[model samples]
Target: MRGAFSTNKTMGEAPEMFYVNGFAKVVPEVQPNHVNNVDDSSTWYEEIIDDDLKWSFKLNSVLHKAISEYQDIALLDTKRFGKALMLDGKMQSSEADEFIYHECLIHPSLLCHSNPKTVFIMGGGEGSAAREALKHKSMEKVVMCDIDKEVVDFCRKYLVANKEAFADKKLDLVINCAKAELEKRKEKFDIIVGDLADPLEDGPCYQLYTKSFYEKVVKPKLTENGIFVTQAGPAGIFSHKEVFTSIHNTIKQVFKYVVAYGTHVPSFADSWGWVMASDQPILIDAVEMDKRIEERIKGKLLYLDGAWFHSSTIMNKAVSKSLKNETHVYTEDNARFIPGHGIACRP
Candidate 1:
């Protein structure tokens, strides 16, 4: 463990300095063989969701942490969530509840379309998106593009739940900027899912969420009846309201119809929001949508079914009002980057 020192200054005489040594008074001082030691005293991985709220998990062991070419990548073996992935200090996914997020993001868009063949996923390096997309028998091809190759490699080795997703024959793994590649390709996709990280200013995802990116790059790649959806961040009334509203409003700029929906993911500790947009109508009738899932989508699903499809799509009243009042549209020139909360190591 690393140690820190503090000094007390005297009035006129020479100032006195003192070294606190070890973890600090608040954290228990227990040295382990490895940096990520799992014992009575373990380190924590914490992420701030907003100014006042933060979520943390006890890390049994830190598998890897490296400065990838584009961003910082971290893989941790956690007590509650199992193996977890953190990109640039933000929680990307955890073993426990990743299905809720991946399923909600991919399925709603794909099932809404009559027959989605080709799919493009952005920033879901863990391969869960591709795995969920493949469950649709109509899906012929899935192109998973992520800016950081290291994150994908780490997840492939350590993330147990969806590791096989990386090896599926239909998945084309591309380690590059997604928007740039999609712009160059003439082929169009029936479903485009943006499973990207929060739009921090210096991060690679900031520009992808802007109005111009969707209008110029993403819109061109979508088929006439295609659907586009992206993770819109925390949707709780007291959480990151601005981020959720901005994402919804921005997508509305390009598509003829847009809908914002929220679902609770236990690992995320909030009702996370996602936005789906399309020129064609999205199925809101729960029964009809459920029938389509049963006929078209294969395999057993954990969270998404008939009842879930109906309940999860309904927006909270406060969230609806927040969207009405929020006028800020995220553009490249006027993007605001929100910093994550601090992480603390506990005894």
Candidate 2:
């Protein structure tokens, strides 16, 4: 399912329309009125997370821009975060702190498993998730599935940090809807990572976060002692409370044990939340976990270690109470995730 790259469209033009699999669709054009307009006076890219909260980065240059079938993709060279990737106006990853998000999202679950070999990554088109998974010497194969081929191609071309990952022969790139692809595949993995975008109401990822997707599509694909982990949402008590708790509670319904954790990602401007769930115990002794990580993972890690692993699992009282009180389960019928709005810090 490879998408053809078009350098034909010019800036400020109505976006071109293309057909995929018999359906006619128009690639979303970046409106001149949107943030990061790249006018003569401004070179700043702004990401509006909620109505009031937005983060702005000074752009060095525009690396690539595309309106894919799934979402609008932009790769920008920023003064602070280096090369940054954005999907539909949301910041996905940045060079300066990407290791924090990718390392936290990947290593925790992989280290929790006794021996994680085969890995399946969903929606991590940037290649960092697959890169981290391959860090383990025991990793035999990694399958990274993303819905939009253009995102993967763009990242591979402009994001130098993940270049080795894209070139790794052991990696298998699949461009398709992850849920549909996983359902058809007969092979199961030791670690299943959901490195998807925030599930907004009209977003492509809303269905992926639903209880039905986890129960019917994801669970059966895991090995007996396998672990499932995903990026939950912003961990601020005042922001995105329902999004975090709903993911936790929904996964709790399927797995015997579930734990929610948080870590500060500078580019995101908040302590981001992540959830790990497995029928088997996930909280291993800190000492033993450290030993396994040292022995298995070969490269220098940026943000995660044994002590951080134990501390990350421990949540504040307010967060714990919120999870305890949250009774809603996210199903396909009731899946409406509205991203937090309200200005936090002005650029």
Question: Which regions of candidate 1 are displaced past 4 Å?
Answer: 1-39, 341-347
* Model 2 spans > 4 angstroms off: 1-42, 340-347
Q: What is the C-alpha lDDT of each candidate?
A: 0.78, 0.82
Best by TM-score: 1
Best by lDDT: 2
- Report per-prediction Cα RMSD to one decimal: 7.0, 9.3
> By summed lDDT, which 10 consecutive residues of candidate 2 come out lowest?
338-347
Candidate 2, number of clashes: 7
lDDT of 1 by residue, 220-283 (tens): 8999999999999888767746588888888888899988888888777777889999998886
| Residue pairs with backbone overlap in model 2 | 50-341, 51-341, 51-342, 52-342, 52-343, 53-342, 53-343
State candidate 2's TM-score.
0.85
TM-score of each: 0.86, 0.85
